[model samples]
Target: MPRIKDLRAYLDALAELGDVRTVDRLVDPHLEVGAIIRRSYETCAPAPLFTNIKGTAPGYRLLGAPGALSSAPGKPLARIALSLGLSADSTAREIIDALAAARTREQIQPVLVDTAPCKQNILLGDEATLDRFPTPLLHEGDGGAYVNTWGTIVARTPDGSFTNWSIARIMMIDGKHMTGLVLHPQHIAQVWQQWADLGEPMPFALVQGGEPALPFISGMPLPNGVEEGGYLGALLGEPLELVQCETVDLQVPASAEIVIEGHLSVERSGVEGPMGEFSGYQPHETSMQPVYTIEAITHRDDPIWPTVVEGEPVDEFHTATGLTLAAEALTQLRAAGLPITTAWEPFEGASHVLVVSVAADWRTALPGVSTGELTQRVNDVIVALRFENLVPRIFVLDDDVDASNVGELMWALATRVHPTGRRIVRTGVILPLLACYTPEQRHTATGDKVTYDALLPAAGKGREPRSSFRFLFPAEVQQQVLENWPN
Candidate 1:
């Protein structure tokens, strides 16, 4: 992996690895650029750099599918690996292992610099025009071109000790202002509510492009009051250089391509949503979301706007956020002393599905444990106890199978999980995106969850040893087979 010091360095590295494609064709932000990027993500193609975008300045380029997976052989997880400072040859297990290791290592503080390339051009007040940049309208039915796709929002609590970094979509309402949807359940929205309750607008700074690690950290499932900057610094083995926003007190990455300084109005809200979400489905209704007043815009000479083409599985958002969430879940479960061996985010279904593989010893210890009992226990431990929302299904597998491999998991489910005996279902509100249950089943306070025990029983009464070939093979034969096979 190339050493990524800033956003520009990361872009250069992508280009060098043949993972970035620069297109000179003029594409419309209304949908053309977004459509192309979405297709690229589905095909696992290179990132599309739209240099000539309709209704935008010449130099302003939009980077689509920035962190989408790569098609290159031996580099399936390349996009995430690059973002996390890993080699393109890194595997999914390696990526998760590295992150888990970094979490335990010493924290690296950010190096503060007086001036950065992002400040090369500063637009404030009337001069700061969001329309000048090429913001892509991701979906055909989207309300407008969203400028906040894959962008990081930095906001500090009133007391200043707790800082939050998160990703939220922002639509350009006008030249100097925009409207952002802050879901009631999200931390950012909750913080906005707190400020609104106190009759104060929440100060915020939206960063377009910075170190890829910044966005990765923003999407992390860390505990409350944990600073994303500190997490990012620790992951990168260096401190992130930050600069104060022109209008807001919040500090942003000094090397960010574009920074929008603004505040969320407590007393005001406008119709927000109808934008395609990570679930690959559009919301049926638009709600009154918080309004953002953009006070300033700062950028480098030629900024590259990173974006995610949100739709279905295999999109940039799914691959990026899914891997991050899986790694986080594993780390959290281990930290909590859970007897989990592996965790995975299956790409076929929505991001809400998490498959956890555990040691057979742990599964056998809880004998006669019904599916409902196991589901309730696991759900309580993962969601109710950890407070990590959005997970609806937890499929537990034996240690022999890899949770990341859907095929192996499906095989286990087919042979081991009996519908009448092992299938578990707990109905309640868990994930809003789950199409299986109706709205009535969703519970805001404590949602319902299910766990499927896809493991074979060790022993059965009045039954022969269920085919030893299915469970184990001779160690000498396995070694011989592996040795005889050609690379």
Candidate 2:
């Protein structure tokens, strides 16, 4: 099948799979939209397409829980799989493997186009106002209506050596201004620092409702200096078409539904956050973040805005970021010469825990390496890659257990991991978003990460046969049972 070209195409595909709910009745953008999206994620329901949002112009629609987990039977990851151009029934392992495999392919640079659907209607200077669209207040205690939750914020270095497309929460300060949580170490902030050093405002293009894969790739933790557009092209097996922004020099997806052009202030000037984060926490404290001054706005006819309610598990942050992080981990571990077959970040873990599956033949490949030695090597590799912060807890299991399946991972942890000497804690940098950290640790960004070696005993010395249906039953009996399952 041809890859989905835009958000509309993705919605159509989702509708066909019974994964989209069109909310035609009037809905409030304040907390109603957020509550609905949150409910959808919690219940694994369909994506909500709000067609009649209160206080917004007619046809100015919003898509909530765009990348949230789907309720489709046997395809909980359907939304994520569909975003990657995979079948709705694709497994979690398939999605991760595809993302990781794309990293090995030749990067296909994006092709520039003169015009785009995003430029269908253009508003310049004071004419460009945020009130034209429905900016949803995604949480009850959110600072304001967030306008860029699921959008791609395009930024570049002052010298133009690196162009980064990332997703950061941007709240609407007014009709012409916004602010967000852009912090150090993130590529957006890194680029902003370069612009600050040059004494210039950082130009940004916030593109919303682009091709389905745009947000997925934008939210990824790709290596520094790697442009997301090219990586996206590589992932889709075709060059993504781009169009230059009206006010900024940055280029955006040609098929984008809406594009907001602006410049980030050289200095912090606005209070932002106190919004619910991916870790399902809503700290009452807010911080001063850089202000974004809007210069131009462009959108397709009856444009659709996409927003992700970030709190709790199984949301876009968990689905998209979790998969991408696992893919990155798999790639990094394999490149480091570890006998890793696959890796996964379960949604239940909320992108904090990484479960890595060791190759079944690791013992043969490593001669007589002890389990502890293997665990230490894996931990060292993770620390070396500086992924300790992103992955706070890690579980290492053998290939017999599918790491992507949370149930299997838990089973491995319960049955294989020793009561003592299996869990190792190492000091590392930690993000404050994690709820596990204490106030002091959150303030200092320093903490200990735990790694659990859940691998089975070496050479099957003390390993017992798994009593699961897949392993316990004879092949013929299993097939017969499956054939007669409906009976």
Every model's TM-score: 0.90, 0.97
Q: Per-residue lDDT for 448 in model 2?
A: 90
The regions of model 2 sitting more than 4 angstroms off are: 483-487
lDDT of 1 by residue, 408-457 (tens): 76776677666675655654435454554555554243456666766555
Q: Tell me model 2's lDDT, rounded to 2 decimals.
A: 0.87
Residue pairs clashing in model 1 are 109-239, 110-239, 110-240, 429-441, 429-442, 429-443
lDDT per residue (tens digit) for residues 1-487 in model 2: 5798899999999998899999999998889999999999888888889999989998899998998888788888888888888888888878888999898888999999999888889999888999879988889889898888899999989888999999888999999999998876678989999888888999999999988998888878888777898988898999999998887788889989999898999889899978898888887778899999999999999999998988888789888888887898888888888889898888888888888889988988888897777888888777776346877888888888877777877777777777777787998788778888898998888899988887777555987788988899999999999899944
* lDDT of candidates 1 onward, in order: 0.74, 0.87
